[model samples]
Target: MAAIAGCSGSDGGSGGSDGSSDGGDDSSSDGSSDGGGGSSYDGQELNVLTWGGYEGVSQMVEDMGASTNLKLISSDKEGFNTLQGGGASQFDVLVLDNQWAQRNAKADTIVPLRREEYPAAQEGTIIEKFNWPYQTFGFDGEQWAIAPRWGWEGMGYNDDEVELADLESEGYAAIWDGDYKAMAADAPTSVIPLVMQQIFDLDENPMAIEVSDSRLETLEETLVEMFNSVEAVHQGAAALRQAMLEGNAEIVLGVGNFELSQLAAEGFDWAKVIAPPEAGGWFWTEGLCLVNNPDLNRDLANEFINACLSPEGQRSICWDGESKGAPANTAAFDAFSEEEQKTIMMYKDKGFEAADEILSGLDQYLISPQQEQWTEIWERAKARSDL
Candidate 1:
């Protein structure tokens, strides 16, 4: 079973809330003391600030003869803070959520990539859907980052306790059915968008967080009701899993298929994740971004990104055993085993066409300009639940 720690924020960026920062030994040395003498990158050190489960990509880069210094970050917010606070000088690359990647691009915290340099990240190598501007990772007519993996936020339910037919028919309305003990993951980024979708009946661009005064009021009301009705709001995957296994919660909100996969690994195959057909669920794409630093090795940074776009690098990210996601590389997805594809909920009986259709139906997670308001509303809703 995948053990979850206390959650601080949504997994939309990190993929899993259980990620912890490795505060020690940021540098990694290759066993060869000669420091890859013959390689073009010879003694160059590639500093990477990445999501917890994605540190494996650094090793792939290191194998190419560049020494790497890796630091694990738990959320995109943290990554943004680091870069904006002058931490960009410490790292050459950052694995960030698409929304934050765009924000950083606008803020000049990260530099744009030359399409000509990264052949692996060019068109035809990655899924075409992710190639759009401001949708996956492109911004201001330049590619700000290369998205390598993606996932979604949906409801996880115990099949034995809740009827699958009801979920499919009622959609998100099933959570408020009052028939099952419900719980939610304490992730405002994910939860707020989901509740917004339900209250506004927004099927398209549901992740849009900008709202007028009147619309904000309506969202607040819906969130208050949802929080109050749930049996508990779990802070970590472990708590969510424990609640379901112990029969404390029959329906879980603000989670994804990744959690369901974790449950299945524990021999509890009854756990399942579903995006309601009507409102749909939230989806997030994580990208590899180059930090904006004059001292940084641009060639080596691009090389690291190219390596990550490779089939093996994509596999290291999507099937890392700790956290699983859908690879952005078409070749990487094609290489996945039947069971691996099923586990990531990328492709099952349906082929790539079906998976692409599913991606089309979902909303991409975007950074809200009025984030303070969103956070305030979420806190108010949680307070209502406590009452």
Candidate 2:
């Protein structure tokens, strides 16, 4: 594993772009670099490879007036798979799922975060529940990532097409309910197992990749049935949204605010997103981590991350109107206008407390030993989508 340089002290107090340090020589010396053979990103480009989806950091940094050569890339693959495929040196920073912190830290793919040294990395600005290291973003008493955005995944239905009362009674069975045509993401790794876990009252954590062979046998049967009955199980969110808009699907499984909010913004007022009462819900947090790179431009990398954690950065991430989710920066909620807050359902009347209660009752995703088996099963289920 290559040794990474300590983060450059680019907190908001410094001068550069919008009070952010721009990798200048006078920047406070926070940590030491590995002095590796490769040149620093000081005069070169900074490559950022993100997992899951783009988090808007490239634009945010540029907006903050950064002059660093920024190259942002997005990957649909899980963070662990990216690191396993030798992506560590390819990118200087990774905006990834919070769950990958432990595995990546163990693999030495990410550097320990000294949040105390950075002004924008203040944990106090983050939601209280997410501030706990053991609960959200720490391993072995050290920090690895900064939690920024979070949301839940479960189900979405068009109010005009399906009765809420009927869905409440069916719970996880709503996906298989013959009355409504179903469309789901083809990835059974999270989609099918999560719903089945809810159906049989098994583990509620969607991140749990492992399952007992006997349990998987039953899960496979249940998934085959659902896949065969559905109109089509698309591979990504865009396709699933198309299916819903074209009237091919009435219910979508394994969706979250990222999709529902955009759909509503597009005038799908009848769309409603929820976790079945019986299944609770699955929650995930998006975090920013410094990749372990020998040629890392520590100053620029830290500046980019701090910019995202700043109050303004938090507000822009959630209230952008196009992309929507609960900002991990709790203070961002108050900064939003009344209408904007309501748009994301963060208002008093929207049962924000009630929604938070439901999310609290849910379990975080965890790594399970049955991960490989689940992947194989998911592939089989996908093949049977038309069956």
Best by lDDT: 1
**Weakest lDDT window of 10 consecutive positions for candidate 2:** 1-10
Candidate 2 clashing pairs, residues 3+ apart or interchain: 207-365, 210-370
lDDT of 2 by residue, 152-193 (tens): 666777778888777777876778766798877655444754
Q: Residue 139 of candidate 1: its Cα lDDT?
A: 76
Instruction: List the candidate 2 regions with Cα displacement exceeding 4 Å.
Output: 1-47, 51-65, 76-92, 118-123, 134-136, 203-206, 294-300, 342-355, 381-386
lDDT of 2 at 295: 78
lDDT values for all models: 0.68, 0.57
For every model shown, the clashing-pair count is: 0, 2
